[model samples]
Target: MASFLDIIKRHLALSIWAFSIIAGILLSQTSIDFRAGVSRLAMNSLYLPFTSFSRTYHLLRDRRVENLRLKEELTTSKLRVEALKEAQRENERLRRLIGFSEKIEYSNLLAEVIGRGTPRMPGSLVVGAGSDRGVIVGLPVIDENGLVGKVIAVNDRSCVIQPLNDPNFKISAIDARSRINGIVSSNSRGKIIMENVPADADIRRGDAVLSSGLGGLFPEGLLIGRVGRVSVPQSGLFMTVEIDPAALLDRLEEVFILFVGIAGEGESGVEPPEAQ
Candidate 1:
């Protein structure tokens, strides 16, 4: 009952307009004198209501169209703003990479990340440069932070690189502080693991780890990461070690591929690249 009353209230204006139309039709049917002045006055009276209704309808229609246009303009403005912010961030990252490359000894090719490796293969990324730009397999890649990965496969225009955190990746590393040698590998969770360390080794938490140059693949003294955890198996003679990589592998966008061998090979402390 209350609902029915609310519905009727909402449509009361329409109902009144319909009722007026019916009442006017019934009045016209009555036996009335056809005087010219009275007929003209009646026609004028009926014309006003329909003229107001038509004007109201057109005004409401125009308002709705204007509101839609404003909403579209707002949406487009938001998208443009976001695009500009992203471009600015990318420029900053590139600037940092260029500065880091100039400080390093190796001649490097700045490569942009094009895509990621297949889901079946973890810790791999596809870079924009390939054999066409002299990018060869086994070239080391790094960013402003530290070592990123090594090129595994190369094509004419692109190449695939395996990051240091991949399960199958391994590097000969040493404790930077104590000068102790160890083998670094990745576990299933992509965490760095230093294996085959004697239980009596002089390693502890927060020790810096770096490449030992034993494998001949990576240059000596490249920053790997810091030690996180140290434990010993009850039966084994060696200790289990966890390492944190110097680079953030998951969020890399641009990197430098080392072709000249060592960082700061020619001269040290060069000027930073100009910001674009």
Candidate 2:
């Protein structure tokens, strides 16, 4: 019985193949419209899904690339903004210095501080201006707030300034409030110590000290420092006063060299000498 069924199945498959072949031959003899319609249907069914998948993948990849590019641009923009803000702050500080310098009416030659002296000679600094810019020895150097130092040596394009903390640098100063006079000099402990103040002087802490113009080096009334502490030692006849300099020596970057004009009647307020 199984052998009879197997034979029937094989005959059925052969009959189907013979019938399809006959159908194809008949179709080939027909018009071109039928072939065109079959080809179009096959293309739409087989190629459409593959083409759509490829286009979608490329679109997603392009969007990811665009997002990464935008993020990088934003980071660069933020860094540029920070740099610009720092520059603006620096410019404002310089402008404030310039305005303060002009208000003092002191003839000023601006210069940048290039280097600091060695630790053994910590009371001196090197500046970028020198004799070529009218910088001379004994000229007072100051910053926006007050006196910084004085030029002790001058070269072609640079000068050395001896700060107020130098042992040899002394200035005649008067109390801003009480008008008490004293001599300010540097102590061995790297401090400005005021001496020669009378025992009965009314000098107090926090009093501002200004140049008295007794020493021909510094002009009159230039700010020096404020008195920090005052003490009357048991062995000393004078009051020992400590001063805190107005200029921030550690942070110095720029300074103004004061230039005293020649004797004249107009701007400088001095009359010229008569012909000899």
Candidate 3:
């Protein structure tokens, strides 16, 4: 009897708790205010996490954009700095050329070197002045030290010059001390070759060479270079002479274009320069 009473009491308690929970659920579903409050609570819980995720994503995207913009700005700044440095170097070179030009006696136009010729045709350069500037073909170009090249081709605003070291270049030259005439030409190695020098020629090492003005192309008495070596090859009729150019061909930045035509030929009335 005692065990049966205990069992009944436990079952009654459990049934009452179940009935209470069912009653509360039914009441919550029937009330519109209660249902709205539950919906809002659920939405609020999801909103916080979603809003945080969205904010974080946008912040990362903005940072990435900012970094890219900074990188581009840095690159542009670097390029500007390099350009300024290059301009400074060019200005210094032009100033030196201008001072050298003032000392020249002949009427000449200062020209800047714009470009060099292709590898197939080495020892040639293009200048900034051409026919429009009274520049003409066959005009001799010179630097501070001595002769550089001759104008070969011309355009409205630019001209091509064949340097003294060009293989196709040849000029009549003479020994300043011995007064011996020889044909100075350039070899494939861009080295000066003075040929047709007689075996008994008075030419010797360290002798200065000058233009002879024999072909009427180049004027007389322009310094070419000093003879470096002289050799009498076996079975050769003429001696092979090597010369070092007076001008710095490898570092030419500016050159003076000699106007060799008659006076009143152009507006500047440039005349052929006499040998100094």
lDDT comparing candidate 1 with the true structure: 0.81
Pick out the ten consecutive residues of candidate 1 with the lowest summed lDDT.
267-276
Q: Write the per-residue lDDT of candidate 3 for residues 125-195, one digit (tens) a residue.
A: 99999777877788888888888889988998899999999999999999999999999989877789898
Return whichever of 2 and 3 wins on TM-score: 2
CA lDDT, every model vs. true structure: 0.81, 0.82, 0.84
- Output the TM-score of candidate 3: 0.63
Candidate 1: tens digits of C-alpha lDDT, residues 103-191: 97766778888888757665599999888887778777887777887888889889999998888888889999989998999988767
Which 10 consecutive residues of model 2 have the lowest summed lDDT? 267-276
TM-score of 2: 0.69
Going through the candidates in the order shown, the clash numbers are: 4, 1, 0
Candidate 1, residue 10: CA error in Å? 50
Cα lDDT for residue 168, candidate 1? 81
Q: Is candidate 1 or candidate 2 better by lDDT?
A: 2
The reply for model 1, stretches above 4 Å from the true place, is 1-45, 119-122, 261-276
For candidate 2, write residues 89-110 as lDDT tens digits: 8789889878877886766777
Q: Rank the candidates by TM-score, best first.
A: 1, 2, 3
How large is the C-alpha RMSD of every model relative to the true structure?
12.4, 10.6, 11.3
TM-score of each: 0.73, 0.69, 0.63
Q: What is the lDDT for 248 in model 2? A: 89
Best by TM-score: 1
